[model samples]
Target chain A: MHAIQQQYWAVRDYLSPVLKESKFKEHGRITPEEFVAAGDFLTYKFPVWTWEKGDPSKARDYLPADKQYLVTRGVPCLRRATSLAYTDADEDAERLLSFGDGSAAGGEAEDWVETHAGRQSNADSAANPGSIDDIPDLDGDGAHEDEGLSSAVGNLSLSGAKVPDTPHLDDIPDMEEDLEDDDDAAAAPSKAAPSSNTVIDGSEIEVANGNLLQVRTYDVMITYDKYYQTPRTWLLGYDENRTPLIPAQIFQDVSADHAFKTVTIETFPHSGTLQAASVHPCKHASVMKKLIERMNAGVVEEQKAQRKSGSKDAKKKWMFRRASGNGKDDKPLPDDEDVEGMRVDFYLVVFLKFIASIVPTIEVDSTTAF
Target chain B: MPVVQFTQFSSLVQPTFWHELTRLKLEVLKLSDASVPLTAHYSAGRTIKDRNTGQEVALGCNFTVGSESFDEKHSLPPFAVVAKGIVKNYNTIDEFKNADKRALFSQAADEIWDSIEKDHDASALNRFLLITFADLKKYKYYYWFAFPALVAHPLWDIEDDWKEAKEQFTDKQLLSLHGHLEASTTPYFLVRPAVAGDGVDIAPVEDYTSFFANVPTDSQTIGFFDPSPHPSSPGWPLRNLLAYLRAVHPTTTSTLRVLCWRDTEPAHESGQWKSRFGVLTGGPAEGKPSAVGWEKNPQGKLGARAADLAPMMDPTRLADQAV
Candidate 1:
């Protein structure tokens, strides 16, 4: 709610191109205050809970120790790409000095302090070689955003931080239902109850496809949808010899959920897949919250059990063991709950990967329980 | 190992913008992670003397201000991603009909996949990306602030006048402070960046270093805090840099954006940060270095503040939990 009051730009230089696109039906410039006011993503229906694995080896470490009843191991989808390097600052002194030559007009010590820092500092410095940009008219009224946001807000309880169950969090809009009722959304599902994602191997009746008849395997990929501004999952399947899987092969897996849930998207929106079965993003916060909470509870329960059975000194020893690393409890711990990569049920992720795809003809399987 | 990370936070938080900030926190994190008790000074655009060339040059300027577009020249410096690969096994429900090793594996795998996807659908779709950004600008930004955190370390130690702490600095270091004092009305800290001896880069050492020059090989502990006059208006890039450095990555100790802006218009009023020796404590002079465990690499010291900021990392505990 930046409203009409704060220092806001009606013109969005950063988002103009994307917002002007037809994908987003509603368009307007967003202010920093309003952007921050949008609040946390946890409040969204299908909040994307990203699980970060630092190295590729990190993913291998996420395998469950006890695979007794394990099915397909969940595939961690690629989300972000990163790079970092630490340089010797002293060595960089030469490099830093050689950087773009900005004028540095020398000024009084009182006139050139640090808070005076900004993107314009260099430009302003370039204007006057040795003087500071303390002159009010030049940049004090310059086009920048609000005063410094003192609160970093990193503790806003979004990334699995302890967010108390508050009533306001429950007011999430029914994004899926609203879309289902809209006409001209070409991809909305026509089938009744039990969505494609839920009807897997269920009793739902199968629908007929024009000429496609074979079931196929495809990788489920989730990408953000510009139209709805939400995450949408798409199917990228393959056959033997690694040839791209046909629409039929991918659709075969969706017999029941297929008829009403998906739209055969011939053109891949942003990924490498040939054609995809697109659908609405699925709901995942609850299950993920359950998994996280259970992990914490398991640790506490194990500690409590140990305390009751062992001597106080042994208990003290156990605490030290966990802290210093390597103990019997540590032995039991790894086998119990080490799967920490971006986690999701392999099937559920595939199912919701395209919640917003296939146009608007089919709707998400809202009634089914995950 | 000290990598500042970022991913698309939310729709409100632009992806490309955040992607640019990914490597930012590393500078402060690594400095604090290093055993060099440090401080951050707002040194943007200040004329700094280059020892190598004997030429006085203006340091960094408010690269984050002037325009709304991403700092076209400086912000998104090219960075390489070192991602690890993962092998994915693909199969369908029909493959489970047979009893071969392949069929059995497919059946089991498909079952777990179905259960998790079906059960955890919502949360799975919501994403918090963890990606890395590596660049020299990140290193520069770190030094820009680290200089102050390094110098502020001395002031944090004593209750009496910090001039007592100033005595510890060498003439060269004091001269740098004089340079800072002469350059701006606001006070700033000055220090020499640490190099790993040889012409090449060195891995993390189990030791600490002094922030200044002409010090004894054994003295890796002091820097000069100059009371340079700071700027009045706040800018976008500097604020973003500070906030990014203080970002919270649960696995790592949290760093706070401790820099602040001061009003130079009302010149007569001296605030809490204003020291007696024409030095005022605002900007990078604010926050203390986060506490680090030193049970691994012991630095010879007495002050509680310095000891807590030691950068020793234990291989054992860190390795036990790879997340």
Candidate 2:
């Protein structure tokens, strides 16, 4: 049913006249020029991300020289997504899942978040359960109310269990053992195997407390996807020992909801023969549009509340003035508030927020405020 | 006192390196198996722990090379030791497997030794050889990297427990030494306290004879751009430098103070000092030191590593796999 609606939307979008004014507002899509502009804004504001020249042979003319794509290296992935699911931080999980349904804009989103964190992992909402919540967004709230996603959350855990059944993780135990043997064999090429490294490797990783201190790092790259007209994110993960992670090991770090479905191994467009797991951008624009709409709705609500209370705080007034400011020469600030303010420069920032939901374990968004 | 064991250098070949190798093979190196000079760099290491035993594991230090390595005049980042490398690309996988790896390693080792003995080029100590078989049709590359370091006869023993370099020098002095080391193009250098007594005077390794001429035997200090982050051990490059030192200072029986210069940022502000000072005693064999340095594969075997880039390189496979 959701697939049919997706098809319908795709057809409707194709049949409709192309939007001339800020296509990102109507649809999540942007031009390659906007991609470069957004990339510049991202790098300028955050500084964690830098534009890379990449391979000169693969450089696209639309993007500026030395700005073919954006990259932020050595972003720490402290733990795996599986360990994050049944974890502690409730508020962070709530905020992370607020946009889980992709189109949960306005008042309905609040209810979704209130019950979202405790009951389900990201895989639950990211899977078919999203269709249930999405139904209300499309066919109005009251037509077939059905308890409004509280029941959907209960049913999702069963689907969420299916996440562990991915073929990539099935042989993880044996694979890990093989790697352990490799370490031993590599250090002592003889029968004695009495190298100090053997002793060092054994003690520092797992102590009595059982807290694994292996620090897995990732290099995240964002490239403009011309086909999807959205920024595509690629993750190249490293093991605690700084070896490049195989595809199966990399899958363990990605969110189960999108692991094999939305993310796949593809050669980095800007690089030669270097393949990484990249999140598919086909659905990115649609999800981004909803997130923007949600932000605009929240802004409109806050403005209504402020006007009702008649609170003329100077800071609040400054924000209001900027929101509606029609100055002839006043260009919007680089790190200003997002979306409805029509700050298209904040596109990648919002896109990163979307990516954070996918790879929550990787701290790539730490450099950006929001 | 303990026998010193130098940390070996593991090869970290980037996919772009293979891609560049393929391009070089098709365009430039066709029908010729002549060795080509390439560049690799030694960066810092991360200590990985054993999952089952929970003990600390010391991984071999990595020597990373990439597409830019092929550029004749490529410059590495600060504090990274320039790992001079030679690539020997064979035409077939059978030839790669059947080739005499020991003889090949010795050939490279001999050139490095000649540079040390004849030319007194201090940088020759940090050399690596890469043998590869690029199966272009299948997009699979089979390669092995060996960083040859000559083994001293009666192996050098640590004369004392390792101490942080900061303990031996003031912040101002360390900063001055760091400035000198960063400015020097050669990876190896000589250092001693200034005669007038403000800071240390650092000289390139070529001036080792004159630089240590006036200095007393006990105070003679030599430093190298250390790549390994191992608490107790220095990197593989230091092995050859010691061999060179043994040859040059043949008659001396005095203890030598070795400095593992591992600071990338300046010593004053960064606050993260990885440099170490160790006292060593012993020398290489009389005429030539025996050498042994071949990197082990990921599976703990002395074999070439393989990377299949079909999913990345093949257009049809990539399209099929694309979401």
Candidate 3:
């Protein structure tokens, strides 16, 4: 049964249309060339990350020898996952995610993305507790409203027709309120997340009491997945003493929601014998597509707002704080009118934002101000 | 006074190190079992006290090496000591096991002794050797680590109880010392309070004779980047340094203050460094000293540790099991 499914997946993946355009709005997955382009863009924006060469024996023929993978080393992780109180609500959202293998039977990519959107709302609510009542009800079959676009083969642009149906995507007022709350939360780190458990091992306390000055640091590397056809991120963690953390210990650094399910210990393709905790790339495309759609919806909302307010300069603030690549200036982009979607180069920056949600404590993503 | 016995170093060979070694084997070495130069690191691990004895337990120091060890330009952490080591990769397990273990160990020890005695390279005091056989086909690796220390005829005796670093120097002085030591490249060095005032002055171990020329013999302090967490005894790297010291200053019988410099966190000015100070009195014989050092397996027996990385390394098995 598994072999048959594997054969089917292989066949479908083989037949999946190669993305010719740079934008990955339709499917999160990108061609190898697109992955290289995105990597170059990420490296250009964040000098901390650089393209590194892999072992010659394991080098893929398709990728350049010097640019086989992207690496950012010694990214500090202040605390453990246990330190972050896990709310039952977060677990419910985690269960809603479809992070299974990339089999065609795992349902439509749009449906998977819709569920992901629902989970992100829950995550958003978890971050901003005051907006609990304002969250639009996502119960029943009304959740997967847009069903026509789901497919493994095609480049049907997500923003071609109407805006995505996610309520929070269009709700500018609530998003602004959430941003205000986020800035407040950033100022006062105590009330940052709506955590339930009283097990708060603050970084200062850990350093003061336990003499744990050397916080665990991780090396984050992104490699292109051949089968999943999306970029897969791998983490290699070092403990306070700088000893490599085993897979089990590495899981402690990951958010409880995606610990063992979404993350797996596997041999790094570039470095043959080395194994690391990799964020599974199965649902990457779906998640990326949903994020891109939400980004477009955000722009459309801004465009509407700009039209209503009659502001001379358009503010293209990237939806996310960390993923605000080249959007930090808050200036109107030259291609603001083209608002077709985020350029494909921003795929990795957005992907990193998604990863930051999973590993909230890792500081690598913040190296680039954008 | 009790005889001070140093704790041996435990090897923490990271998987990335093995992966890099495998890469070098396949791409660079290619069936040629040659010695590869490697620089490892060791720091003072956490100090744990025995609940029953109420005494600080001597934990084996850890000497670690990883992917960065292959990068010659990689800068080490401030608290870490550059432990010079060599990797002898064997093509097969039989060759690794059946090889003359004693001969290889003695040869490594002899080279270190020559560096210490003839070349007078103080940095050679932190020499170690590793032998590995990476069975790439099976995704298994058999390895052993050795940290050679020349045996002292009369093992040094601790003349006094260990005192915290804060006991001897103020926080300001320690901060200055920490700052100075952060830039030190060699593991063994001489540290003393500045002649004029507030901070401390540090000089390489090779400048020992000149460093102590003006200072009172009673106040001279010798320090090394100690890797052990033992509250009473220093780590293994100190033994060779002590041996070299005694050989150089044979006629002088004045007590030498030894600093087990264990900076738990050198990056932060927590002033919570776990360093200790104790005085030692004794020395080894003048002639060529015999060396002994071979790390035991986890079970406390002399054997190589084997790691089966197939579950994590095999791509086919991983893919088949993934869905």
Candidate 4:
């Protein structure tokens, strides 16, 4: 323990003089190593939050207010915080859409946007409570698109030619109101479709205005993108819940264009678009398959033994992150019965590695905060 | 120093094996965009050819309401034509109260939909609506899709398809029939990794949206993309969508129509294809997260019991005054 503290001080003391002077600055800033030392001492180690409030120290991360953080192993893990901390569940709900409310919220009020600026509501139409039929019956009105061209969503009451014969007419109960326009024909699918079923967790993953944050249960959802053949993540937020923040809070200042740029899975033919709920990574399942095959066959244990004896193959094994000495989560998770747990670890590990590269001005104490 | 493995062989379970993910969560909004009713006129789209492969692809109808086509005749060709004929006009009408503002900002979303309806008849993209929304206030474009094209799911029987591809109707057009009356359904927000490889061209935002706001002062911003397994896909569709989004609209608050179906009712699979139901459930790529083997999740089996937790959690850590 003393050695660890000494090592920490050694690094900090070496860098602090230069960092505080600002004379060693390159490009008007200190290096990551410098920032790591200076930040820890000035912000974290300083316990300024306690002093500012004139209270006993309450760990540096949980700020005075509206600034929360995740507590892992009883310590705040900002690395994971960079990727995912708090989630404005409402934002996630806003992104998800059910077929039934497609028009009321989708066509009318535009709430589904990856916001960069503040909450920019739709300028044109407010979210309508009324269903399609409730909108003034456009029995004869030409409407937005040409009535002749509006084969699907146009004038339900007027466009008799295309309206009566729609195969799924029975499925649409609302169309019955406008059917008065095409009273002549109404044969449809035999069965009334099952009742609606899309239930979105309106727990805001992030706020619409993105000003603050909340404690997150599930911050981001990742999925395999077969189209791009990579893992796509939905960056719901990076909230630790130390404080209540505006629903729309970003982790750092990364733009939605960069942070929320995600993979869209068009369940073609299914008419279902399932985007990964968060910015979790997608690895080729083959990697895990290979590892699982080895684990199932007990090859990994043998490799571990060989690695202890200094076999060269152990050095080349990329299956376990070859670069990190602390093992995953600093616990040396060399083997486990739960292969699935290992798979999640694999992604978390890789995702943490990727985030470290993007976070830019921080000295990484360990590859993963865990 | 040693490598940290991603697969616990256990931390997370194969979600496929878990009971079907029936309930999806979402945020619901009723779209009442007054501008949607604007008349969109279309002109003929151009046929673009790949520079290296010498292959030609057709761009859907370009919405040029009361204007001439500004098709690029001469250009530094990219690997392939990502998207064609999508334009957002940013001739910011300096409050020309006399000008037909609505007509000036008409959308090509429907035109793209019409073309995709024809182009992606039997394909996956067919089930998606690559949409462009124009917010007259911001003068920026935001793109979205009424997607999750689940039309031709392998599971759905041909005759019993919710909406058939054989009969060409856009996803939204088909949605217009079903989405309205149904209550409780919400679209879930999910994302995919942008898969990039050969034949995938994620063009710069300028390549497509530049022509929309042809003014010298006009600028555009591009969004990020996901890696996909398929090649030469969505590049064109997304480009076209963004083209209109960046040029014409005040903002691209594009919303997608994602169906969030909960558990599959037993009746859905009881008919002819009852046997086919468990292929994925019983097969690989499915299961729930569990600490112990088969302790939870009816779908999982006790292939191997979990190893000791001593190794999974850190065995060495001295805290406070020392244990």
Most lDDT-accurate candidate: 2
| lDDT of candidate 1 over B286-306, digit per residue (tens) | 332221110000111111000
Model 4 chain B: worst 10 consecutive residues (lDDT sum): B273-282
Task: Provide the TM-score of the second chain in candidate 2.
Answer: 0.90
Cα interface RMSD of each candidate = 32.4, 10.0, 23.8, 27.5
The deviation in Å at residue B132 for candidate 4 is 12
How far off is residue A225 in model 3, in Å? 12
TM-score per candidate, chains pooled: 0.18, 0.66, 0.57, 0.21
Backbone clashes in model 3, listed as residue pairs: none
lDDT of 3 by residue, B238-284 (tens): 88888787776677644678888886344245556688888888854
- Give lDDT per model, in order: 0.23, 0.65, 0.64, 0.23
Whichever of 1 and 3 has more TM-score, that candidate is: 3
True interface contacts reproduced, per candidate:
0.00, 0.21, 0.10, 0.00
Q: Residue B51 CA error for candidate 3 (Å)?
A: 18
For A100-174, candidate 1 gives per-residue lDDT tens digits of 223211221223221211111111110111111111122344234223221222221111222121112122111
Which ten-residue region of model 4 chain A has the weakest summed lDDT? A123-132
